[model samples]
Target: MTSGVIRRVLLSVGVIGTGQWLLSDVVHVPGGGLGVAAVAGLWWLSRSPKQPRFREPASLKGWIERCELVLNQFEELEVVLELQGLRSPREKELRRIEGFDVPLSVGVVATEGSGVPATVQLQQALAGAASLDLCLANPLPVTSTSWSWPDDLQELDVLLHVLPLPLRAADLLWLDQLPADRPVWLLLRSSVDRSAEDHLEALRCQLPERWHQCLLPWSGEAIELRGVLQPVRQQLMRAERVREGTRQRLLNNLHRRWQADLETLRRERFRLLLQRSQWIVAGVVIASPVPSVDLLAVAVGNGLMVKEMATIWSCPWSSEVLQVVARQLGSAALAQGVVELSGQALLGLAKLDGASWIAAGAMQGLSAAYLTRVVGVSMADWMALNAGVAEPDLEELKRQAPLLVARAAEQERLNLAGFAQQAHEWIQERNSCTPA
Candidate 1:
């Protein structure tokens, strides 16, 4: 009992210390340490003096209904029907040979004795989401090496590992043997002594960071199943979406016209990532003391952005390919005098005194960053136009680069001041960490 109290105190101290550090060191908030200390004190004061009371668990039917509603929220029924061509008579007849088998096959493995009953309960609860085939597996011992599946089980889409409450590090080793191709979901069942939340935290500590999203806590009671089924339903829906997307990609590959919609979706999805990369690259460039290395840094940053953009667009990614693209784009920008114009615009904004080398470097960095954004945007457009084609036309890209840079400059003019301020703070923080 004394040790528990001591541990709690130590944990509280650690949390408070970490909070203070983030507020003061990372965020640079004024008087952040004292503010965090006060907040911690208030939290400590707010702790309930009375002990928690136990209540009767809800009925199984109530839990089942709640889980059903949660699953309904995912709209799996509508999606499954559409994906399997079951919506209309014509489509249904066409898909008759395919049948209405669940697109995803989920395998449920119970780690402990209690886990077996919990798995059965979960399977019963999920019966309403008829789009998924939930097969409950034999309770596998933690040490078991040769695991067998049901003869009817052809392929497992997702693995649902059911664990008893108060999970240990040893039990998580079972995850190592599971198929890596499929996603793994951990259904944590609470024991009589421990609550579901307690089990969840224990399991979370034992599980790898990647599996954290897959963890779901459930008490044996039906009422708790609603919460547990939410993540499970989401996982199943996500898997279905992935399958549908793959089918779409294959169809697009067969037909050229279908590629337009896929390309547009890819652009929309990766636009924010590209924008963020531009800002990060710009900040890093501005922080560097030397102006001569700006071109090299911008080239490297643009190359990395191209690689990410390629992955998002489902295009082949190679460092060599990015290097060739970057060189062509950089040469065009320089020849068209876009780089020099951007530098002048940034210099005008900074309006720094001649003595300030720091301000001068910042101006160069900001210009390089703006030019990088232009290059990235132009590359995305070129990729979209030449989707599934080999090489980009250097002449056409060169013609478009200046126009794109001018348009980007106009669109981003208002945000530049705010962005520069943020970049300055970032540079300050970065420089403080550098060793002398």
Candidate 2:
């Protein structure tokens, strides 16, 4: 924290804390200075988004640095998966490429009949587009064999799908499936439609959300379409000036794919960890003699799960640091009666009530396990966000706790059916093995 930011934060906290102390009804929690400071700091952080950026850089060099950070995040994800004896898709090193060249490559796909002639007119209109090698939507005479988009122009920076209305279902599906990496313009050649603006209102209902603005209405000669493209040309020109423009766009495409792959792998590995951890906690609870012992046993086991989760994110948060997060989330859950609610809702959630559930201390054990998962997963999110930044102290964790816990609870509620089945099976197995 900078001296100025720290001074301002302290001043605000001091005013709030003094008011809180003077008011008898307010909470006076011991060792809650961190949570108190968290409230002010979070508000301050929200107001100022230009917080000390670490990986964010200027020009092409900045892009390269962000790419490195993404690579490292994936590398950690791979390690986490590997520890579980599960192999993840290898994340190859993203290195700097010298003298990189980028082109505003555009692809055009047109409907048959009059659409083919309209595309040729478009080619003539854009004859001076020197930077881009625009795809000829229909280079050869119209035939069933040439209906497909050109295979050679697979890597496109922009696309123009010329359609003679009424629009076809196949065309709408194609546009929907197309990735949002580049701009796509739907060149409509409808005889009945007056202007492209007329089709814009209609196309909004059928087209994907992203392509709503990229619609171009063509009524007169294809050469007149150039006027419609002025805005598109300006957008492209602006992109060209940004971080060597074309090169940055291509890099971003690759980076987005890498991050997406990492996310899939991370979720798979995290699921496996949660499954193992939750089952173990359930076993501990079932084996314990009483409700008091069950809580203690569940806590001890849950702490280990939290530790493993932190290790996966490569977080430097100590056990004490983790406990602070757990404490905040747990208090929020308890205050909202989430603990009691989850237990009571378990059978209702899964719609399962059986002899297995009626077994000795079954409700206590199952609820303990369920609550462990809610708290553990919530901690994982906190760790993941802060792991990239500086290690957040108690204040930051407490500041984020209520929101994160509430979100996690809502998400878990949606998946209660699957969890209920798992709990039912676990209890059945336990009952079968234990002496009656």
CA RMSD for every model?
Answer: 23.4, 12.1
TM-score of each: 0.36, 0.50
Give per-residue CA lDDT, model 1, range 155-182, as digits (tens): 4556677776676544556665554434
Please provide, for model 2 over 297-327, each residue's C-alpha lDDT reduced to its tens digit, 9 standing for 90 to 100: 2243344466677666555555555555666
Taken over the whole model, the C-alpha lDDT of each candidate is 0.53, 0.58
For model 2, the local distance difference test gives: 0.58
Find the 10 residues in a row with the least total lDDT in model 2.
19-28
